[model samples]
Target: MLATFNSSWFKLLGIFTLNQTEVKAFPMRWFGFGFNAFGQICVHEELIKGVWSDAVNEVKVSTPTELDNQVDTSDCCLTTGYQIRASWSRRASLHLDGFVSNESCGKPMKESRGCKDAIVSESYLTLAFSDRLESWDLQKKEQTPSWSMKLKPHSSGPPVNLPLVPGGYIAMKPPLYRLLSPHLRAKSLALSAEHAILLTASGAVYTWGLGSHGQLGHGGLTSEEEPRAVEALWGMPMSCIATGGWHTVCVSDGGDLYVWGWNNSGQLGLPSQGLRKTLLQQSSQLAGAPCQDASTTPTEEPEEEKHEEVFISIQAFPALLDVTPSCEIRTVSCGCRHTAAVTTTGDLYTWGWGDYGQLGHQTFISSDEPQRVEFFREQQMRVVDVVCGAWNTFAAGVKEEVA
Candidate 1:
């Protein structure tokens, strides 16, 4: 017998099916619409409407474009000088545009995970894997034997790959490597141009390398060859950490953000006025200036005092930053001179160097404090991840209404 079916009910079901299909098909697309001076935006040629060729300029993007290539997974992606290397689960693709070199192509990496997980500096590329660590000289276009080291088995445990030695190992252990030996269980590592930081599973942070700008989180501007714990956060348990060109950031177990190091660009979320005052104070001290009595000095107005409290130029030690006063920060990432953070509610905040719109504020104005990027909120999207290039920012977000 032929039965009459309710067409209205069928239509409703079809609409629901279409919605689900759309959600699945468009699962959070990656938006990389920032600095592209060297063609690091990674969008398909057809997708790029205009180009910004200036060494440090922002791309005028009306909308977020989907990344051309699909990345299944990645250990990390590092950029330096004029090139970018994106590490995948099983391999890595090195992108070098004409701005960087004469050729523009993707160089397939070796099969090993270490080869895929790589870091780059102005003159060299270092790859780290489970078995060994290798270094390639970018200037010479040849591998250096002295720069490479085989993973050695620890006396108490299995083989562990040592951190990348910036220069080369000498007869004596570099101060940084010496400090790392005592703490054999390293949970994570972050590097910049001249410094390296290691976070232990127990929430301790050790840093070594160039400290000219106090990026090491120590209370002085001196480089250390061996890793040294950041005393300011000695007892606080940290969950994650990241380093920029000359700054450092870390999050505590309770989702508190702490920052220190170079504030020349206000990357520390502090005001430059305080830094100037600090420099003057140091200069006076060196000149053996006489100390003024508090009773003889004029009292600062309440508003002026409040302003001074927030205008800090340099924080040699880790200082707690209350950027998301009401929201807890889940993760943080740093660009060459910019900073980005993700809140538990999936909101994204950016600040610091924005000359190339790396701060993602829709404008190329730098910020001294963390500011929320309203693009995600305006679209009813939730940011799930954030990655920063030296002069750019990338974010992935999913629709809030998607089930």
Candidate 2:
């Protein structure tokens, strides 16, 4: 065999070994770019020392800043309101600007699963998982609920009561066990200012809470007491979903993106002029339609009715969006009014309200259509994830290896 080694075989083996080594050595480096209105970017002090004269209006970063040192693990939430860092060893730390109490900072985790989900608002922060939830009030500087509830898991027998804390009963309604319903077992959830969206294990999406802006995707601006399926998205399996302050977004398994709700900020990616024109045309058509009463004189059949038109200030139905001509969207996230999407090919696109430079375009201009963030492409970086805060955007990328 030593005398019969093929040159092509050796070359292939060398290539394979190199590829394996690269894969093993690949390190994930995080970067926080775009808006840093509230120190949410979390950049090193040394790097941004001379960049800003006033803290309120920070400089816009077109290039990525390394954050691996500050963020111990990839499981972290960098929101415009607050930041939560979960270490690799399963310790969690909550950070807020002069809001969190001394006792709650760097608190240890009680659940073995660590912090599975974390959400921050202007006044509070909440971390929840399958078994437990903890909340901290920013104004009061104290942990909320002030009590715990006794509950039994689905596998256990009948429920039993346990001693309660000082704040009376917390009134656990729609009991936690109800979530185990065969048809409504939620796999993930996203919360906005007042709305909540839940994605079931079966690829179905259900939304509840505030529907005033049609963020619920129920084809009506009516709030629901219970979770209701997004009727328009029925049968179209969704893999991921995100909620903005007043908008909702979801991505299908086939890479299709659907958006609904508020359009005042152009977050839905629909042209304002076109939408206004459509609304006017719809009003004209409705005004011209013959009275449905049989007693009224018959008129020409409304120009033969070519197609059905739907209009709503709040898009109560999910509207399919074509961000790019050919790119397939893999994931999407929404800020207060802005939206960001990552394509299957590691391309990042952003649109919607950008008054704070959240769109990553190096300017404070807002866009209606999806615009690719050129920084990543210019640096030959591959964006793997994107997160949007109330007024900022954070992206995680890895350097692509050239073949």
Best by TM-score: 1
**Model 1 TM-score (2 dp):** 0.66
Q: Among these predicted structures, which one has the highest lDDT?
A: 1
TM-score, one value per model = 0.66, 0.65
Deviation in angstroms for 59 in model 1? 5.7
Error of 2 at 82 (Å): 16
Candidate 2 residue-pair clash tally: 0
lDDT of 2 by residue, 1-403 (tens): 1112222211110000012233335543445555553344445678778865676656455445654223222334322122222111111223321122111122122221233334344443344433554443323423243223332353553211111111211112212122324457566666665777878778999888889988998887889867888878989989989889899999999999999998866788876543444445555577996334432233665756544433334677999999998989998988888899999999999988776777887666677778998988887889877777666676767688999
Across 1-403, the per-residue lDDT of candidate 1 in tens digits comes to 0012221211110000012343355565456545654444544655543554542333443234444443322333422112223211011133221111111232223222223244444444455544466554333523242265666434555333224232322111223233346443677777776787788879999888999888998899999998888988999989988888899999999999999998877788887653344445555677998643422324565655543244565678888889866999898888888888999899989888776677777676677778998988988888876766666676777788756
For each candidate, the alpha-carbon lDDT, in order, equals 0.59, 0.58
- Please give the clash total of every predicted structure, in order: 7, 0
> Which residue pairs in model 2 clash with each other?
none
Give candidate 1's root-mean-square deviation (CA, Å): 14.9
How does model 2 fare in lDDT? 0.58
